[model samples]
Target: MTKADVTGNNHTLEVRDTEQTMAQEKPTLTYFARRGLGEMPRLILVESGIEWTDNRVDTIDDLKASGKLPYGQVPLLEYPDGFSISQSGAIVRHIARQHGLYGKNDKEAAEADMVFDGANDLRLHSRATIGNDTLREKFISEVLPKWLGFFEAHLKKNGSSYFVGHDITFADIAVYNTFYNMQILIPAAKLEGFPLCQKHFESIASRPRIAEYLKSRPYTAT
Candidate 1:
């Protein structure tokens, strides 16, 4: 299906019953209304050209009350067969592998793993500081630089816009989402010296599918 067919302005999927379409069942991603950990996986799905469902929960209480989540957490991936997977990292990796975005070979996959883990580290730190203005400021001033600098160095070493080799991998998406969420949390935070990191984020965000998804989806701070 075309990007327009899968994700129109309303951000809703059109159900189809063709044999091929039915065989390739659309997965459903359950997450909070905010982007949070689910955004990257959503981006992966979009970039991979998969048409899926976005099941957003209005509140944590509502999610807990549902009692269908395997781990009582948002960002759960549920398949058509009623199987579900939890944890943001696992879900991202799963989708990446399914979509051939994990990496090209063993060496590239290892590099991708390193970059993805590093991005997750930064994400954890940023999430922990949310809602605390003082802590958030300190993170933006001190911690963010360390992580962003590491990413900048890696991007420079890679000698390309992507995090791993010539193509965009899960690591690239992870890093982009990390920076994207950081901007949401700390809008004033700037990539003063990290031109590569800035470019990396923009590159992923500007992908045709990713850009359309961003434009269609509602803004939600996490």
Candidate 2:
């Protein structure tokens, strides 16, 4: 079969029929050795059952030396045919769309985007307070509850365990990953006020593929 080429963000992608053959070489994902922004995309890839290479570089020096990255950023997803895509959220959306895990329709997709954006905002806010003990404490005591309460309300409105539609979506994965990182960063912080969100996290975590991947990797906040 002929291969099609698609480009994104100044990068080229060789689009071959995904059903070509199971023996076809898997794509490669390059990132720092830590979970950080790459974790959600990795989770999507793993849960989709797509075979991919996890290329972990330990240092920025090593990454620059490789000359394979487009933006010199970690979490770059590269195809076997030399095409690659950068940016964590984009990579996660690409994989989710490819695997039919993005959403069911336009409305669902929009809802998913809403949840993803909200989760990302929370993640950024939490990360900004990382090294400062006082800021982190204040964030946990005040800011965290507001965001968690918002998520809890959204989950209740959706009337399902997933953030969008009845099935798992990238939004659920995104929020879950953020929550997972928050727990890692602040072990004492509890989700008691957000029971629905807590259950939602557990639901995503218990997925067969996700559960296996979670067990295989070491605990990391980044």
Candidate 3:
């Protein structure tokens, strides 16, 4: 995408808004953000050609009184009227299923979930180090290599650019978002030698929808 096409204070929040705005006039997904997993479902909303609203939930009071349906955990999904659905993977799969990001069939969707689940593992591991540089380094230097390497080998064996079959799926999006988002927070050099992982990250991450989103808003922690 052209640089002029993207405009925002930062790539992070802008991407969130980009996808959040994408969920058009359909089932309307109300999401709770943990700054990571929630992003996948949000991407589905944006990619689905739907326009929806974003509501920030800060305090527990804010969460409960905001009138969202019960979510055992976030990122939660709420219907237009406020019925809530919990579980990050579930929210993501639901949105993907609704928007066709899950894939063409059940088996395809399951494959998508496989990729997505791997991405989630990486993200949760990354989150363990919130602001601890030492821990973050350990995650990126040690843990991430194993994870990214595994996926890269899998993708190579599959003989495709994406994580799933030929088409894009929530799995691809999840891995891309998690990997790229981590890069935003961590140095790429830390992931050196893992070329396939790095390549897949750059490719899936460069989508117009996503790049445009990044060029607009570069940072959003929560």
Index of the highest-TM-score prediction: 2
User: Mind giving the per-residue lDDT tens digits that candidate 3 earns over 152-192?
Assistant: 78889878887777887878878777776677666642456
TM-score of 2: 0.86
Best by lDDT: 1
Give the clash count for each candidate. 0, 1, 14
Model 1 C-alpha lDDT per residue in residues 1-222, reported as the tens digit of each score: 674665563333434335456556788888888787788888888888887898887766765777766678878888888777888888888889888998899899999999999988998888888779888888978998988889889989889879899998989988888888878777877777899988888899899999999999988756
Q: Each candidate's TM vs. the true structure?
A: 0.83, 0.86, 0.73
| Model 1 segments more than 4 A misplaced | 1-24, 59-67, 131-134
The lDDT of each candidate is 0.84, 0.83, 0.68
Listed per candidate, the RMSD to the true structure in angstroms reads 7.4, 7.5, 10.6
Worst 10 residues of 1 by lDDT: 9-18
Candidate 2 clash pair list: 36-222
Q: What value does the lDDT take at residue 206 in candidate 3?
A: 77
lDDT of 1 at 50: 80
